[model samples]
Target: MDTMRERFVSTTSQLLDEDARLALVLAEISKDGFSAARRRHPDRVINVGIREQLLIGAGGGIALTGLRPIMHTFASFLVERPFEQVKLDFGHQGTGGVLVSAGASYDWPAGGFTHMAPGDVALLDTLDGWSVQVPGHPDEAEALLRQSAARDDRVYIRLSLQTNARAHASDGKPGFRTLREGRGGVVIAVGPMLDHVLAATEGLDVTVLYATTVRPFDSAALRAAAGVQNAADVVIVEPYLAGTSTAAASEALTDVPHRVLGLGVSRRELRRYGRMDEHLTAHGLDPRGLRARMARFLPGTPR
Candidate 1:
């Protein structure tokens, strides 16, 4: 894990250009282990110290000058604080830059209620010309950053503070490929818990959509994956309270059998954890826990 962190950090530390800039952002942050990234890349990483609104304004300025800026802060502050600036800067001008948001839900239990922000995705999704991607793993994170940086305009990338199980990507699998093949049902899992979907369908005929970009979705690929031939059953999973990613996919491709498996901190369990790692484990988001959830979907299988 230390070596992996170093590799990611080295990759991101070298991102002076647009393409490398985005990948480096995700890799460097992951390697930084939360606070370390801010220290490592303070120039690129403008920490407004919980001021999302000011951060957005600064981000706009950086983007306006043709310098790419990747802003990091808590999800709640990001959504509640600087929406207007985001609209005026990135949204109105269709400016090109990247925004990396952390603390995506019950990730900051120590910070109390003000820090828990589950509605961040829902709010960001409504913005136009913005690409929203909730990556499920490190590899996907790398790929999303690379892709987003290559494109122009506002790109919003979300990360859960928790570490996700590595998918088969390390074995030379393309980050955006269809991970699983199911003839009867197609289950798409986005965000950080895609490893769960891959583990859950050990034997079942399920096609897994490992999408990094949540908004400006790959509708053509999604429709192809959930073709009319296999419309009887399809399941979509996300780490948010409401299955917005899955619901959005279903709405995009109607007449497909789609079920959303939303996993997040319920109000009843808000105070049960502190770090994102603990919250992920408690919410059954860990690899082992995800295997168990898959068993419920595919009974009689060894989880």
Candidate 2:
């Protein structure tokens, strides 16, 4: 199966063909993939070289003209580097565009810390009116991307190299999907962490909730899932920063007597440049590590 990034190039190319209002701005990140599309729609498919700020600025400018722009780049450059541009160009201006990003967290370990963006989601949380989607599979990525392209909203579709073994069915709506049911607790897995989370909680009596669209966080689904039990014990496993969605989960269950444990990439940087699997194990995001941690937090859960 193709990676999410590859699927993004193909899907966005199709969008450009289907919609005249859609425009794509890139900073030489995945320029090669959109070569044919660029030839087809030279005016719409733009490559702004290595200037990250300019990439967002151009996309925002296009949005100003009433054209739906999709900005593509590495996560670090797309969100972290041009954050000011993002805040001013899109949020402050009330402009709507889709920001599609690759190189999630530590997807390319050889690229070092500069390429990783474990805090991207956390940073976006500081801003308002932004819809964030973290798709675990290429099929989900394509679906979310197409959805974002159809609307003129400030949407961020996070694409990662890590993915689940299979794609879960979605109704193209922004909410969590219940994969398993139990009264012991609820495990909410975001994006690529679903497979590992499922494995970790295999024997544990917990309801597993899969989330692709995080922002406008489906508080209702969370509430409904937790409402069955007297007390809610929630565990959020994200592919980005560990505690990125913990606060959001807490807010969703504010009235209910509950506890939340956030799991994902650690703040402590791993100095060595290793494989992605190595990084996953180091961050305690692998199945073995997750099981150990989840077992400790969940009462009566055998390790």
Candidate 3:
């Protein structure tokens, strides 16, 4: 019986470039679906055997060898445990490797504190030249992963364990699309939260920046969008803490008024949730909350 993971592997194999070697590096640790995914991408996947430091370190080596390494690890292990390795081996050297970190927040209840990663954004934000891509769904995830693999910069791809809540329109727009084009406020979103931003556009005249490449953002597009917003109306949203987009936006648009709507466990409480969807909705990070917040800046739009 074929499964989603199987289909994902099948699709990936077809989409990958013939000469490109894409390796999936599992965390020093593993997840529920890790083994199955490895089995699917057998020849192309590399399991690092629970070594976070080695997981990233080896990626650097693979990059030097011209193979595209997608380091598949838990957010906690990748961002917290071997952060130094990531900075030294990947970030500083600017190796063209993709960090595929799953369970980026408090998604897995069984993983416990040691496995939950809530500080990755903060850690990466302090560094420069690192491109971050937070995809909203399987399609976006696949697209961004391929793009990152093709690039020669240090790329980080954050993944969520649960299915995404939104699907891109079939309107021929790339997986990453710009929703609203108003010059009022720029609402940059990643992950499933994009549904909220689009819904919130019911009556506002804000410009929505949908990113397929979280890092190496389109400077021309971002600048064009920022050129029209009010000084304080530009906002960014992510399923993790605001650190990722906030820092990126500040650097990208130094003269704009910027705010970030960070998701995941609050800085104060990390142990409170039954499911990923439930936790997101309870904290006003879901569609309703996004719509409400966006409404403030784009009052001219319809209800």
Candidate 4:
């Protein structure tokens, strides 16, 4: 399967070729992947090397100069490391760009803590007007990136190593997509967490909601998916930090009381180096772990 990172570079190159207003900025990480794009549009695709702050600053400068810039790099280095640049250069300065990040959460577990950034979205929540889309598959990633590149919004596209067996359209918009129907409650699956969510929720009496765009979170769609004003036992399974969307979910279900359980990379650091499965087990975010947690949270399920 083509990974999201590969598709991103490809689509970006294609977009840069087709659109004159598009520019791509990289920070040495994915520079090799974009060799062809850089060659085709040498001046547009700029790689500042290892300096994420300058990468974002150049993006902002390009945006200020009348071109939309798409910034790329690993998640931690892209968001957490040069966050001030993101804040001042992009946010405060009002320079808009499409920020695409790969290595979702702990996709690089062997790379250790410095490589992981589960709090990227949570930190993004502190800012305003940024669209966050987490695509579960490469096709979705391409589509989202394509769509965002066309517009001039402060957008963040998050790509990951994990993916589903198949790609889904789910309205082709940023909102709650109901894949399965039930009455127990709703399980909102974000980004690449869909596969695990599907496996875990099997045979359970609950509605499963899939979302590619979590920030600017579709509250109305979420409310509608629950089919009730007060959605009880609505679990949000994100690939990043746990409880990342609790506040948005709460505000969405404000009309009535609801119970929300946020599941994802836990706040606690394991302090041990391991693979993805090991991290999932530690965080209780794998299929088996999620199933056990759901059995307890979903009102009355057989133990």
* Candidate whose lDDT is highest: 2
Candidates sorted on lDDT, descending: 2, 4, 3, 1
TM-scores of the candidates are: 0.74, 0.99, 0.77, 0.97
Model 3 worst lDDT window (10 residues): 1-10
| Error in Å for residue 219 of model 2 | 0.7
Off by over 4 Å in 4: 228-231
Model 2, range 54-79, lDDT digits (tens) per residue?
99999999999999999999999999
Alpha-carbon runs more than 4 Å astray in model 2: none
Best by TM-score: 2
> In model 3, which regions exceed 4 Å deviation?
1-17, 28-44, 92-94, 162-176, 229-232, 255-265, 292-303
> How does model 3 fare in lDDT?
0.64
- Tens-place lDDT digits, model 4, residues 137-166: 999999898889888879999999888888
RMSD of each: 5.1, 0.7, 4.3, 1.4
lDDT of 1 by residue, 30-143 (tens): 433445544655556544444557677877777777766666555676655677887788888767777766667776688887777777777776777777777666665666
Best-first order by TM-score: 2, 4, 3, 1
